[model samples]
Target: MPISSLARSITGAGRRFPPPLARDPHAGCAKPDRNLPPDRTASVIHKPHILVVFGTRPEAIKMAPVVAALRARDGLDVSVAVTAQHRQLLDQVLAIFGIVPDVDLDLMQAGQSLDTLAARILTQFGATLDARRPDRILVHGDTLTSMVATLAAYFRQIPVGHVEAGLRSGNIYSPWPEEANRKVTGVIADLHFAPTPQAAAALRAENVPGAAIHVTGNTVIDALLAMRDRIAAQPALAAGLDPLAARFAGRRIVAVTSHRRENFGDGMAQVAAAIARIADRPDVGVIFPVHPNPAVRPVMEAALGSHPNVALIDPLDYPHFVRLMAMSVVMLTDSGGVQEEAPSLGKPVLVMRDTTERPEGVAAGTSQLVGTDPDTIVNRMFALLDDDAAYAAMAQAHNPYGDGQAAQRIARIVDDAHRR
Candidate 1:
């Protein structure tokens, strides 16, 4: 799909899309055979049902590996449900991973308030639970979907598993509800699949039982490694970047992305200014995939749209984004997933937020926090772009995240959780 049409497919804006994967009533699990004896059918129906739920693009990316891992196991039935908090972007990842959501809430509105979105997920997902009756459900990260889904599962007395749990920025409102979201999930989740040791420790500090906490490295690395290998084998999978590679042949490319709600107006403006200033250098080119959010796209376009060296394009599919990260000298973003992903590719990430729940990167010399202040963003990014020594220090391909087996570990843990 062309980039323009990809953006509009979520809204049906001037584009006709074949419907997404059809909803399957039995989901990834099999329907019990009615022809068989009643005793045998009951046994088949009791084969532990695991439901994987997520809403946004990041959640989809991280959970895809877990879903794949679970499906590969014997005697375990896995189903996927996407609430689609971020409609088209989430679809892009699902297509890349070949994930067919058993239930798509289809709950995105043009301009819905957080309270409204939460209410819809709570009620709709509650209905899905009533029908699916999963043995245990898995939710990823700190989205509102995960939080309310956990609440719904708790009300129904179903066990919940949290992937990428135990991250804390110390200040709840700094990440603007995400910090709170993850903490609340940690409280309710019987299985906490933390991405790092620090994250596991945070959960312990919160009085969570250590037995429940397992440091399964971030699944983003699993997803990243898998795509990176695919791009390596075929190379055509990531051919979307061929044009950009030709456009900025000799110049150093700086891949950029930002869509954090905290950095809406002024914060976005600062990031744009920094990009424009970086683009001023003839040797450096900025390739920013402008986010489709109303608050983000306008600010960035108004500030840096006319810049000659900058390519402000629509968001790329998973392989293209990974290809961009592999091609870039440095990554600039406020995305939590990027913080974990870029490092595995040996790309130093300059975060645009004041605080990050994933602080493992900073301590591991893989990423740096350079808030949204244009000066800070520019100066910090320049250090990596200009100084080879500085760049090499942060460019260590040693990822503290994971070794691409997180999903397997998570699958094993989930299997154990139900076996008991």
Candidate 2:
């Protein structure tokens, strides 16, 4: 079978997947109902309202599965809200998932500062929360939008359910405001849906009540698996990737994605330099979905643009990216979600960051942190390319991030909590 068809078979779209086992390694919380509905006695009461909020493309990709799961349940009334922090990118994911946000704050500006963005999100989102008056608010990952939106919900006294929660890099400034954003959300959120046992342990160490934290796995896998299936079933969904697929035919393709704010200056230059060196190999082809940010685009294009084997194209939509991942030999990224998703596709990932909050990937042997050092990046890339055993080890490692049933588990947990 072709690679795309094989991916479809693995995903098993339109069929129900088995739920993740309700075993919590942290030993603080009770086993949640695996597939049970809300308590029958509480059915007479009104269905709980869940307002799902996200802004950036990554958040939308991770949160879309949770929103779909909540919408599928009978016990929950689900609504979506987007801050549009990354307007075009966010909309692309929303369209892929067919999610129509109940509110769009349109918070993006040409050259907005962090302080200004935070203030706008807090103000606009606060009013939206007041008007909608949802029973609970759900935020995904760590963006300025997630942090400020959680604060808005807190001010309204509405409980916040944080998806992909409990990630910590220890150093608050390493990932810039992301570490602080998730930490702030962690401190304020009422219900935390941690992606791994390690993440849950981090929450426990911080004195968060065990009952409030549930190991639901990461929702990014759910979104990834779904998109892979869709792209496979309908090849047209992957049209954006066809040119690269044809261009790199019979060659080892390395998919590259690096756009973290911290990797702006010297870090980006080093990454570009590394890619230039990697592209010199005749057998390898590099497909980089260059971020449009002024900090990244100019540096990357200047460094790698003239290279025939290096294709630095515009950012792709969800389906297109999934297709690229499905076809690639390996992935090089600074993206947290990519670290998690690539392992599931049995693709080895070389992380470009110095530190990562998703240590579960590294511990599981599915990914390695190469940082932004040009030598480090190039050496790691060559090892994966030249050493068959090294590549297989990382590709075949267990994906600790998820099993694609995270959204279902989160929906069931939310239903059970709302009834109480």
Candidate 3:
């Protein structure tokens, strides 16, 4: 079937699934099977049900590996539910990963506030939990979807397994609601999959039981390495990047991505100005995939759109984005996942945020925080462009994220928990 048709079919079929809880949550946790042997052993040998939930693009990217891993197990029944908080972007990642969510909340609405989004997710997901009643629900990262989904499951008395938990920026408002979202999920999740030792320690400091936390390296690396390999083998997958590759030719490509809500107005303009200035160098070229947000697109286009060497294009798909990172000499971004991903490809990163929750990249010397100050961003971009030694230092540093076996570790952990 055509991709577009398949997507429509999935969306249409999703709505036909039983609406959230037509019955009580605890009324019938399990359905009887008349064909099964009438013995205690047979009754006890039922497969465990695991429901994995996520809403946005980042959550889908990080959770795709876990979903795949869980599905590969023999005694587990896995289902996926997507809130589609970011309808188009979320669908892009799902298509790339070939994930068709069993339940599509379709919760996105124009100009919706955080309170409304949270209320809708809780109500709709609460019904989903009652209908599915899986043994456990797994949520990923720090989105509002993750937090409220956990709350919904908790209300139904179902356990939540948090992936990429235990990250703290020490300030609640710096990263806005994300820092608080992750903290709340940490409080409620039964299993915490910390991406690094530091994250695991953070959870321990919160007085969370050490036994519940597992340091399963960031699944982003697993997704990155896998995508990189697939792109390498099937070059057509990265055909979208071919045009930019031809356009930049011999120039050093500086790939940029900045759309953090914290950097909305002034911060965004400064970063755009820096990119415009950095493009003045004849030997360097800038390829920025402009975010679609009104606050972001206008500033970026007004500032860098006229630069001859800068190409301000729409957002690239996952494989194209990975291909862009692989082809680039450096990356500048305020994204959390990029900090973890770019390092694996040996690309030096200059963070556009003042403080990062994923400081593992900074400590390992793979990424440096330059904030949104145009002067600082310009100076750092120049140093990486002009000074080979400085660029090499960051490019050659170790990626502290993972060794690409995170999904296996997470799958084993979940299986062991179920067996116990």
RMSD of each: 6.8, 9.2, 6.2
lDDT of 2: 0.84
Per residue, candidate 3 scores C-alpha lDDT tens digits across 253-315 of 999999898999889989988888889999888888776778898888777777889887777
- For model 1, the stretches where C-alpha displacement exceeds 4 angstroms are 1-28, 33-43
What TM-score does model 1 achieve against the real structure? 0.92
Q: In candidate 3, list every pair of residues with a backbone clash.
A: 20-127
Among the numbered candidates, top lDDT falls to 1
Off by over 4 Å in 3: 1-45
Clash count per candidate = 0, 0, 1
Q: Write the per-residue lDDT of candidate 1 for residues 41-131, one digit (tens) a residue.
A: 7666667888999999889889999999999987688889989989988988999899988899999998999999999999999998887
TM-score for each of the candidates: 0.92, 0.89, 0.91
1 versus 3: better TM-score goes to:
1
Better-scoring candidate (lDDT), 1 or 3: 1
